[model samples]
Target chain A: MNNSEYAITVKDLTKKFGDFTAVDRITFDVRKGEIFGFLGANGAGKTTAMRMLCGLSVPTSGNGRVAGFDIVRQAEMIKRRIGYMSQNFSLYQNLTAEENLRLFGTIYGLSDREIKTRSQRLFQDLDMESMRGKRVGDIPVGWKQKLAFVAATIHLPEIVFLDEPTGGVDPVTRRKFWELIYKATADGMTVFVTTHYLDEAEYCNRVSIMVDGRIEALDSPDNLKKRYDADTMDEVFRMVAKNAKRAE
Target chain B: MAILNALIKKESLHIIRDPRTLLITLLMPLVLLLLFGFAISTEVRNIRICAVVDRHTDETRAILERFRNNEYFDFQGLVASTEQNRMLEEGLTDAILILRTATGNMESQIIVDASNTTMAQAATGYIESMVSGQSGNSPIISSTLYNPQLKSSYNFVPGIMGMIFILICAIMTSVSIVREKETGTLNLLIVSPIRAATIILGKLIPYFILSAVILAIVLMLAYGVLGMPYSPASIVNVVLFSLLYILLSLSIGLLISALVRTQLAALIVSAVAFMLPVVMLSGMIFPIDNLPIVLQWVSAVIPARWYIAAMRKIMVQEIGIGFLVGELTILASTTAVLLTLAIVKFKSAVR
Candidate 1:
């Protein structure tokens, strides 16, 4: 993906809640069809900044465009063009998998027949087609995570935002979840993801680490590791975050 | 249109899937309606009364017979001797009716137990009308005490409005939002293309309709089944007050949900801090006028009180707009303010 293939553009995006700044001035761009990992810890402004990109929230003082729409003036359009999954594993536990899928599909303006066809295809693709009838609460956590991803991108959004999507899944399940993420990107959906998992960050085409509400480093996983003279993404994260805090 | 439909569908799922919210939303109105219909009533149809017939004359006997026939009184043990004091001191009955046996003067003296004025007044009116023709020129002097006329319905109508408003609006609203929060579906909605206004309206519309249904059911029971007077204007008053009260109640519910992360906390706060006051101080089951001065002032701040006041004015007194303008103004303004606050709080929660 070239510069012309940028799916999201951020210019000094800042978000403040009262006097405490949640996301300090941070800028980055996500290219089309690329798995962009947003790495940050708790209260590191990861969620806040993602919220801005998702168009669910506005930056306190910044200019940005998401999915080729102005963040401020075209938020509604940006919201329409993107999918989001929060760390809490967003799915209605009470409803059956089919009901949840149909709901999101319809909300995204899919017709009844389209929703029906898409839902059937989604269940088949996930290899848990029979689980569609079961209540989401009764399902295993791994399946729920994968279902969440499908629901988020059911409309085939140009850009999909995943906020720590694999927060508590087991290692094997997390690997399977990454496979689904890769498949989504292969279909030309831009994956703008946030996660605390350093290994997951390593799989990203490009990664940005946020600390104290600011992105301290942005580079390809290998380049970040090379720059910090570290063996792994985890060590690179520790070194950069430490230096970023010290600079502050 | 599509977004609104999605929200409605999601909201319905939340309401139906969560047992706690379903209980509060559907069962509350039914329970309160039954409780008020059976246990709480203003019309004293079978009030226990103790009457003293001073002289056992033919005319007086006939008059006493008239009293016995009256279904409103449950002629408790009668006293032929003039022991009015004993009748009341022993709590024998609500009031004592004295028929004078002054032979030459031919007059009737009716004394009522002043403690319960409503009973006294009703008994007084009955005796006066019964004996008026008994002795053509004789004078009938009746004195009433505590709550003369026993204006039970007058006290109940407004109280009903307030109680129903809290149950219908506030409890239902909070429970609905809390259910969404508990199920983790709120985030799903936030991710959807549904607009904020659409979300708020979607959650509120069903509860509003349900409130209307409750008002209709209770009103029908109050009038058709219970033999309470059916006032066309009062029915309109109930409907209008209910719509406004639902908005206020829903707003309170939304505010509670927004402030608290969990449904349990929202439920607790809404019940203790909101529902209790609207039920008690709104003067739905109790009279704010009789409450302490401080409580009376407090009642002024309770929108339910104003709603009840408007209901009472329209239904019981059959008063005109002049009687309700003040209460109506207060209720309307409070609703606007609460709704605005709720919107702001809801926005913050989403953020």
Candidate 2:
């Protein structure tokens, strides 16, 4: 229960779809209440690895735990402890925001009063109370992303896994979204996020750069820059990506 | 339990908001029932026939007159000889009846166009009855033929019920599942604590309820509107048969949904792969017994065929429950097997 305890641990985890190895023998750990960024190029297996840790997919081999539950033996427990906002648009497009939130709240098993109260309060907190009646498909993509994030975490899960959550958002909206992430982390929820944006990696407490089904670099943004003798995480990413390709 | 309740609620919202799905769910079955009941009929009626009275005798005219009153044939022209061939050839008439002139010691001969056999047979029989003067009152003979009463609704009611069940249960089940896939909500659910089985159940339960309601509506239409038999045996038989058929269709749909990545693909697969067997070999359009030996076995696996057989027995034959147990067993077992495979395959495929 200590704050410094590991919230997620993966040792030599791997996944293969037929002959294609999506996630190789990658090992990592996420401390409780920390923002852990998973960065990779398209098809670098970042989403695949995140999926395994979230219990959406079973690993071919290795061992892991999420929120102190074994990934192998207690995948359902792991799933219960995590919230996921997938890269693809996830919310029901035809439903109003209030209805969507109520449904997610119901899925989380909250009482009717709890769902009513929480949805009203959350919309107010997000400054989106006026848009609650609008269908999600009618709203801007940026707003939908933010609403999806809120819907994903309505259950107050211990860890929230966001896969490319800010893919198509404006810079200002992305910044606001990061503020939401920070707010959640501050409230003691661990943020396990995947993004292609290196700047987003800088906002994380630590990050792992995956290339070709393996993690080629893992450190804080400052540490990775210093270790690779680069000015920015982007440069460090390119260098590690080059070496990962060369090694393969 | 909470997650399931929430997910189900969310799904209901999607179904309600999507006007296309709402329209399909509420109206499709009833529309199809009405279409099949009132519009489509297999009984050949009002068929046009031309007769040639070569002798112009009173007896021959009496025989020709029978075709006018015959409900089966629409007697068109009573030409002497030249126009007989022209009428049959131009499609103005389905058959030509030629009464040959008699010789001193010869009986009069009736030559009917061999083609268009149903009309030929009806005309020929009417002529013989007139000649024999056998006018004693006898009961209408409904001897062996495909659907003896020529009741289109007798066969169509069951056929439409099967078709409706397939459309609502199979297509609707896959639509819900594929929507989840397309929107990436399925991934979210998979990653959540919800079991794959629970997700499948959630997708199925609504459609099942909807299909049951559809079945009830169709049954009422078959009985009340069409005046098809509505005995307890037929009603119970259709309900039970359609339920099993729904499960089979839905399971196949779920299996296809799991295999294919897109809703379009699921729709195509359901139509091409599932609907064909139900329509062709299920004895809805073509009788299974009349098919080639290999295809007869093929029809054996078609749940629609079994349902149609069970329906015909209950509705037309007025058979008791003992006659239906075999078909019912096949339907039930097939459903169970398909459902088990669907659940097992979906468990991994979604992940």
What are the TM-scores, per candidate, against the unseen true structure?
0.79, 0.91
**Which digits, one per residue and each the tens of the lDDT, describe model 2 over residues B161-243?**
77667766777788678877898877777776667878888887767766777777777777889888657865776677777
Q: What are the DockQ scores of the candidates, in order?
A: 0.48, 0.68
By DockQ, who's the top model here? 2
Model 1 C-alpha lDDT per residue in residues A122-167, reported as the tens digit of each score? 8998898889999989989999999999989989999999989999
Highest-TM-score candidate:
2
True contacts kept of 2: 0.83
Off by over 4 Å in 1: A1-3, A243-248, B40-154, B178-184, B231-233, B258-260, B318-323, B348-351
For residues A26-143, could you state the per-residue lDDT of candidate 2 as single tens digits? 9999999999999888888987788788776789999888898888788877777788898854888878888888877776667889888888888999999888999998988878
Candidate 1 lDDT, B294-328, residue by residue in tens: 98888788777777777766666666666677877
Q: Report every candidate's CA lDDT.
A: 0.78, 0.79
Considering the two chains of model 2, state its CAPRI-style docking category: medium
